[model samples]
Target: MKRFATLMLAFALVLGAISGAQAATIKAKGQWAFDFSWLDSGDFTSQDDDGNSDDDFSASQRFRTQVDVIASEALKGVVFFEVGTTVWGRTDGALGTDGKSVEVRRSYIDWIVPNTDVKVRMGLQGLSLPGAVAPSSMVFDDDVAGLTVSYAINDNVGVTALWARPVDASGNEGSDNNTYDEVDMFALVVPVTLDGFKITPYGAYASVGKDANFTGVTNGGAEFLSGMLSMTEFANGAIDSSSSTYDAWWGGAAFEMTYFAPFSLKMDAVYGSKTADDDAESAERSGWIVAALAEYKLDMVTPGILAWYGSGEDDDLDNGSERMPSVSPTGWGVTSFGYPGSVYRQDTYFGLNGAGTWAVGLQLADISFMENLSHVFRLVYMKGTNDADVIKNNAGVRDAFTPGNTYVFLTDEDSAIEVNFDTTYKIYENLSLVVEMGWIKLDMDEDTWADQDFSDAKKLVFNFVYDF
Candidate 1:
């Protein structure tokens, strides 16, 4: 009751301030989306060896809405607030019961400096890397109380600096594990444009609290309880006795150029390092992915292809030693399922993901047939190389790695292919309908784990969006 009263009081104050302000423009925007999906088999396969099939057909539906409010010059300084909520249930195990549960996604105040190209922003906001890799889809909004400053050196070159305290370490989220007090992140970005070419060089540093260790172990055919017992040792080894701090830094550059009219190329690369603050234990991890894309505008159609490679880090299998292992959710041939924040990592803390190894893949997206109707269509495909040692080990049974251990598990190296078709059509002036179909194939030489023969999987999804 007290919390509700406080909220009501706050809303009243906002309304009163708006009413008393001088005549000035205020702007507001909102979006509401509903997504539905049906899976041929919800059971993707588990590490348990109970011989019980985990694959089962299932479907889900979800509704998400976001609202943004901006108070213009009437308030002297611009104040913005954004909130999001889930309005429906999803069959996927990830989403919880939903009915207007609102969360603040962004709330900040921008103070403009008269004639200079400088502004100071404070309050909870989003921190994003300049590159597309770390965009909203991959890394959700990191709620932090921070300050940002930007300067326009010239028409072509601009710079920005930011510092923030991550919400996780700020005790704002209310977690029992509060051993680490705070996290500090800083980044610098400089963008320049010359003729038809543009380049941006960026650098970022972050000091993350390290109270736990990251470990990954395979259960082989063992039950979940047995696998947990065997994996305890690896988890215990990743902890540092001293200050318990993990320091990480990353730097990268991106370039885009247009050689011919209507045709352009894009590429980006990043390198990163993670080490303990006290130096009692340290590991060097770095990888770079490069992609080249070409696009030609044909009225309303745009198509492009991309090729990329990453040297993923190896897992630390032995104390003070590391082995090249495939990471989960994104390593080898696995693609993460579920939406942002709800997604789960195979191994949360300890894994061989920090060791530098290599992976190559390609992707293609095209927009076809958009005319007369308010609809657009798109298609995408991707593939990558797999690690032999990582796949052969089969999660733990030593015998599984022997020459006779020819049983190929679901993690075995094989070509993975995914095909997707999506379309969106306007139903009204502010509402639209979306439909999508996706198919995945894993061409394996032999089946080792699930007695069932290996083949392919398919899924279908639909969505409706309303904009205001």
Candidate 2:
């Protein structure tokens, strides 16, 4: 009798498992990209270990896949994984090809409130503030573990709020770990739409603990934060570091007008500030940025003019930096080689945001003479807005300010011109081949670089992409 009862229980459990599996649907999609590229940085001083020059040509590939389990339109869970960029002939992708490169890029769940219009997304996910620009946001654009909630009040208005913890040093067990060793941010955005126009205004605030370990943060968080702190009292004078925290805030608005078909205009403006909790005069930094683009779409091509300017550093380091502070800017400009133009597998400048500069460009995009083939041409002139006195008067600031990607850091007398001609041809509905060529002529001030010869930067790339 006891054996009979055990068998019956096992059968019931199997039926329940089958019922649950039938209630949810599974879906999957992903992309694969392979690249053959050559890049000449034009910096003669660059060398690898053993005092050897690094190679400029390489082949690499990346793959990403996302799986979704959905019960309904408003309820689903997603898990995204990536085998990140792996260079050919490297240990990871060589003959053995046994590299442990697989990473969980994102994991999240989306659900709506019962009988309500409010929706919530919770987990490690991508977060980007609204911007009129095509590629990315300047202030904050990255993936972090966070909770986001959104609601649509009507057809013309909506709101979104988010809370994210980008860094949490409390997980470590050491002197650097403390109760306040973490960074948290809160933000809200209100979007309004009317006919052919739309605008989104946003505000965000962050609390940075004094002992927070920025080195663990990705996308150049440590570099930018340390650079800004160098201009403040904490780095130059005696201050009670244990009792102080940093407060950072940003406000911005993005606008777009497309009421007139075939012609459109877009603009983005933002201001940012950071200060110590004690409000030290030497610990305050603030700046602003404005950018605009106007484009007219023709039958064969779309011509556009883009321009942007950002406040740069003044001569007084003791008064703090005048240049704007950013979280993680993607640095998408007219060309991929000069700036971190929006491209797959080529976003090499992981954390260097292009602040303290100005630029103007003319773009001819979507230039296609044949089906399934397209081309883009861009010419950009860029210069720095920072006063040269900051580097001239300060000692060691020049070398310390140089990040991994040294192409975009310019001074008042420094300038560069970039040109890009890229082409793409679709082989199938989900496969394409692309070739990109780029060049930049640098004009560095002799007095600043101390007679060092700066060569022109060049790039040639071939990419094969497949998506589903």
Q: For this target, which candidate reaches the highest TM-score against the unseen true structure? A: 2
Task: Supply the TM-score for candidate 1.
Answer: 0.67
Per-residue lDDT tens digits for candidate 2, residues 186-215, read 999999999999999999888877666465
Cα RMSD of all models vs. native, in order, equals 8.8, 3.2
Model 2 lowest lDDT segment of ten: 231-240
lDDT (tens digit, per residue) of candidate 1 on 42-64: 23323244565543333333333
Candidate 2 C-alpha RMSD relative to the actual structure: 3.2
User: Any idea what lDDT model 2 has?
Assistant: 0.76
Candidate 2 regions exceeding 4 Å error are 1-11, 42-54, 172-177, 217-243, 280-283, 331-334, 348-354, 403-407
Q: Could you tell me how far off, in angstroms, the CA of residue 336 lies in candidate 1 after the best superposition?
A: 11
Model 1 has a clash total of: 13
Residue 91 displacement in candidate 1 (angstroms): 12
lDDT of each: 0.44, 0.76
